[model samples]
Target: MSYIETTMKKLQRSSPGQPEFYQATEEILQSLRPLIDKHPQYLQQNIIERMVEPERQIMFRVVWHDDEGKVHVNKGYRVQFSSTLGPYKGGIRFHPSVNASTIKFLGFEQIFKNALTGLSLGGGKGGSDFDPKNRSEQEIMRFCQAFMTELHRHIGATVDVPAGDIGVGKREIGYMFGQYKRLNGNFEGVLTGKGLNWGGSLVRSEATGYGLVYFTENMLQAHDDSLDGKRCLVSGAGNVAIHTIEKLYQLGALPVSCSDSTGTLYHEKGIDLILVRELKEQRRSSLIDYLESHSDAKFTPIDQYPKDGHAVWRIKADAAFPCATQNELTLADAKALSENGINCIVEGANMPCTADAQAHIIATGMHYGPAKAANAGGVATSQLEMAQNASMIQWSFTEVDKRLQEIMKDIYQRCSETAIEFHQPCNLAFGANIAGFRKVADAMLEQGLV
Candidate 1:
């Protein structure tokens, strides 16, 4: 291995907690490997080590009374990754999978994602290991009340803002926001993704998914191509995947397949957006239920894709968006995508591709868009929600969507220009790392060894 590779491998193994954090840092460091010689301070200041670790990691116990009058306890966490640019801002996830390692990696990724948005919000993530699935409304409310009881002290409108993530949706946000209001006794924008009647922005829900398509559209245009006739595969049946499909349809692209944790469904013609929305949002049922409703669509377990590789990456598509989870796409999958002539990849989920998978794409000269740059649309629109809340105004969908598109285009340009300036054209990971890192690093320099 080369010196840069050896350096990154050494640093990666020295860290503690989730393997995902090391996976994420190794991807960024590999991309930025060429820059260390010129910017020796990156090594001297130990920015790789400092940046890979969260500034503060808070874990606490949440105890609350259930509707059954039973007291239950759950683990909660808030990882403040970086506060270089401004106050901490990220979403709070409530899922069975949430833990310190998961939160740490997420918070670490948020630093760059927030910076890429050109917003003055630093990076942080908070959440609990409480799964809301299949729970009664009262039970969810009780849990949210309990979760916020402990989380309320650490967040504020100007301090750290938390929004919806994964298992935390509008209902969860409403409960938490109400608790925050009750505790603070003032109407402050401490949380986003609230109901429109409250203070939520018009396009916040669709921002991340739609923004992924918008960024992908720009990348395609740069290559003298478009999404018009491309066969698209999007993983995940959640909010992000659903809306990403919607926007892809709007832009004349045919999204053919989507998956849930259970299985993947492929429609040879195209996925019906209305039916999909009803099945996912209204019914909150399985993707399998959609298959039962539509006999024409084919349902296959995640492992059943025809190719001998990861199902999501093995599919023959003009484009692929992995909206599922971290490290979902493995290195072998990356090699399959390269062999299949996959045109472009845009991450709709945080750190969806493993470090080796990312390196495979970079080595193959494929168009790769990192999560920090591609997924900034979510936080960018979240910041817009904060602005709307502060001003007591709600923008129309067209106006908000137009701004989202503009921000995505701006992100594309910034990454592109940075890549070119660094003599690594089309290397978006490098562009994003350097571009986002410079902003936060400069802020840290100004703050002076805090």
Candidate 2:
């Protein structure tokens, strides 16, 4: 059997029922075939085998008390996939959908994403099946403390640092950090996405969204196009999607849509950035509330989405940003977008597109950006936060944002150049997987077998 085939079968057996993790591994392994063929040394050393298996897999039960004095139990996971380049780094998500398979997939993708940033960071991901929506403040705080009580032992500033994702945000981070501080009795940079007054770097929250746009702009410019005056569809109303819409407006693009768990919202003229931020970031309300302000906007409930596709992709637009969640977009969605003349599709979330959907996007000549490379802004800025914390000095917002832009540009240049080198010019996803793998693989080779 082929090396890729053999490795995949083994992974399937070892990680049974983890379709998401297997899908992520298969994607990277398939892309790495070219690089592997060029470097037989990697095979000889069994690098692929070592790289797929995580250095550590942490599974813990978090028991917390809610407002009504009810006990709750949730599964928590921390998959420290690799530390070949530097310290283990990734985000801590809090959502009902979080599971070992999801975390594993996210952690595996992190290895390549962190590598693409040209930063001294490794790959890891942790989360729980705890849903933060509609929970009382007291309940949320207690849950954060309970979760941190167990998690604090596994992480450290220089060993494994985690930021926030999805349901886990500043509120949750604040609670967790406070608990860690009370428990450890020492102030350290063990986490990113901290509050402004507390060790957190500026522009960190907005980094991922802005970085997505920056990368998208870079790709468009490379193809002699730009986002100026384009109608864009952005999925998700979280930090990534909200910030993506914000930056799109700043770049003169009309972002027409943003969605959440409830439904998708589309404003044909343009999305009101301020209102979205208010509803999602502040009010914690649903996208359905948007129609109260913009009476003309359209709201499509989740059930009302096309049977074969998604609501967000059905809208006619020049570009699409899938910033929602894993496998949210299917091949039918890609086809629908292509039919509507949407060409530029940049992933703002980890593994947002299914394997087949991603293939269709590339096959139809769309300017596609994979999640590992395109959605790397959040982690990149987290590293910057780590640097600021380690140095005991915080840079100005403009300074931090300038660094973010430069990093995004470098990532684009590297991915693009590597794609050209491999004779698949503009295939950024393939280039990204190859470039990221080579960096980590080479480092692992030099560091010797662990």
Candidate 3:
């Protein structure tokens, strides 16, 4: 067997039951075949083995009380994946699905994602399996405090600084920040996604979505096309999906569909961004609430979805952005999208597409943007927040956004140029994996064994 294959077997044995982490690592290793052949130095240094291992993995039990005086227990995790390039940077997700497997995958993906940004960031991820969906504010605040009470010890502004993901947001970050301050008695930029009045940076909330669209525009502009009048399919009703819809509208594209955990929404007339913000950001209701406004729109619940694939990808569109969770788009979904002539598939969520799905899209010559490169905007903006915090300053919305746009363009160039260099032009997944890995691997080699 090949070295990459051997490494995969060893990882399976070492990190058992971590399929998501393995999937992510496998994708990168498989894509690096060409690069490994070109430069055997990385292999000689055994960078693959060292790179896959985390610097530190902390798991703790969180005990918090609800408003009703009932105690709840949840498992908290913080995986410091890497600090080779700079400080560890990623997000802390609060969802029922969080575990070592999920966080490891996210942190592994973040290592390359941060590298693609060309920023001084390493990789880390933390979270708890505390479902925050219907919890009261008091309960959430209590839980956030408990989670951070332990997480604060392993993280700092110069060490591992986490941002928000999935169920964790501004309010959660605020509670955690307060707890961190009370414990350490030192106020610092230990976390991103803080409230605007605090040490937060402008354009941070909209960075990932705006950056995804900017990357897509760069991809299209390279081929003499644009997002003008293009129809889009966006999945997920969270921050990334919501902002992606907003920026797609700004770029003259009609984001016709968006999905939540419960169902999928398809409005041929275009999604109402204002209503989406109200339902998701404010009310936190299901997409079914949207049909009350437009009877012509279609809603597909999870139970009624096609057995082969998700209902969202079956719709016809010019481009598709799977901004939901990992492994959302399967091979069937990719085939359905291709049948509908959806030529561009840019991932806004980490490892959103299945291996077969991603391979199929790229093999079909689709203008594909991998999540590590496409979704690096959020983390890049987080680094900008770090800079602002260290300097005790913040930039205006326009200024931060301009820099974000430029960064997206630069990332697109790096991926596309690397693809051409490797004789795999337009296969951005390969390009991104190679480019991101090379940077981290080189840094790891120079930094010596840790």
TM-score of each: 0.94, 0.99, 0.99
**What lDDT, from 0 to 1, does candidate 3 have?**
0.94
Instruction: Tell me how far the alpha carbon of residue 9 in candidate 2 is from the true structure, in angstroms, after superposition.
Output: 0.7
* TM-score of model 3 vs. true structure: 0.99
Clashing pairs in 3: none
Q: Which runs in model 2 stand beyond 4 Å of their true positions?
A: none
What is each predicted model's overall lDDT from 0 to 1? 0.84, 0.94, 0.94
Query: Candidate 1: what lDDT?
Result: 0.84
Measured by TM-score, how close is model 2 to the native structure?
0.99
Give the alpha carbon lDDT tens digit for every residue of 116-223 in model 2. 999999999999999988899999999999999999999999899999998988889999999999999989999999998999999999999999999999999998
Of the two candidates 1 and 2, the one with more favorable lDDT, higher being better, is 2
212-236 in candidate 3: lDDT tens per residue?
9999999999999999999999999
The clash numbers for all candidates, in the given order, read 0, 0, 0
The 10 consecutive residues of candidate 2 with the worst lDDT sum are: 306-315
Cα-based RMSD of candidate 1? 2.4
